[model samples]
Target: MKIQKFGAGVFTIENFLSKKECDAYIHDSESRGYEVATINAISGPEINKEIRNNDRVIFDDTELANALFQRAKGFLPASLHGW
Candidate 1:
């Protein structure tokens, strides 16, 4: 697999997640009650109730977070490691 690197210091691995993985992620996120997306504003953030377009899910699972990080860490720049 070829990792595409952009001039703006952005790297992407095409087809990183398979179809089954995507389906499983969507199912898990929906089951966890994270389908609702929030609206961001200068004052504060508010829950969007009208049209549900974005399904934002927070990474509270440490194991999952660590695993994903490990998988993508090699593609990331070293300067972004600490912060």
Candidate 2:
């Protein structure tokens, strides 16, 4: 994959992930567990309808997280990280 700079503070990597990788991520996330990602107006965790309908998958597996990070590190700018 090639890293392309879009503009200031904007970058993209087209087709960075293969279909198999995406499927694996989804499968692993579903198999592990998923919780409602909605948050309340006060910034607290809440499950309010109409606000959001996405399930957040917490990665308790460091190996998986690290592997993904490492793969993207080469394509991502260091300045855009940890900010």
Candidate 3:
């Protein structure tokens, strides 16, 4: 993987995931299905087409999530902003 610093707090990671891995993720998410994406509003979560007109899937796949996180952890700072 190649990591480039575009600016402060901004970066571009190249080849983060292989084509096969990406394809698998797409298949998994599609199998789960999707719903109209929403944004956090002042009141609460709501759909706002003007802000975003996209679909997303909210599923619980702890194993997959952890695997991805581990893969990314190697490329991320150990801590951010003292957190």
| Best-fitting candidate, scored by lDDT | 3
Return the candidate ranking by TM-score, descending.
3, 2, 1
**Total backbone collisions for each predicted model:** 0, 0, 0
Better of 2 and 3 by TM-score: 3
Highest TM-score against the true fold, candidate: 3
In candidate 3, what residue range of length 10 has the lowest lDDT sum?
6-15
Superposition error at 30 for model 1 (Å): 2.0
> How many pairs of residues collide in model 1?
0
How many Å off is the CA of 46 in candidate 3?
1.1
Please give, for residues 2-77, the per-residue lDDT of candidate 3 as tens digits: 9999877788678988999889889988998999999999999999999999999997889977988998888888
Candidate 3 clashes between residue pairs 3 or more apart in a chain or in different chains: none
TM-score of each: 0.63, 0.63, 0.80
Q: Please tell me which model should have the higher lDDT, number 2 or number 3.
A: 3
What lDDT does candidate 2 reach at residue 18?
96
In order, candidate lDDTs are 0.76, 0.79, 0.89
- What ordering of candidates by lDDT runs from best to worst? 3, 2, 1
- Cα displacement (angstroms), candidate 2, residue 30, comes to 2.9
Candidate 3: C-alpha lDDT: 0.89
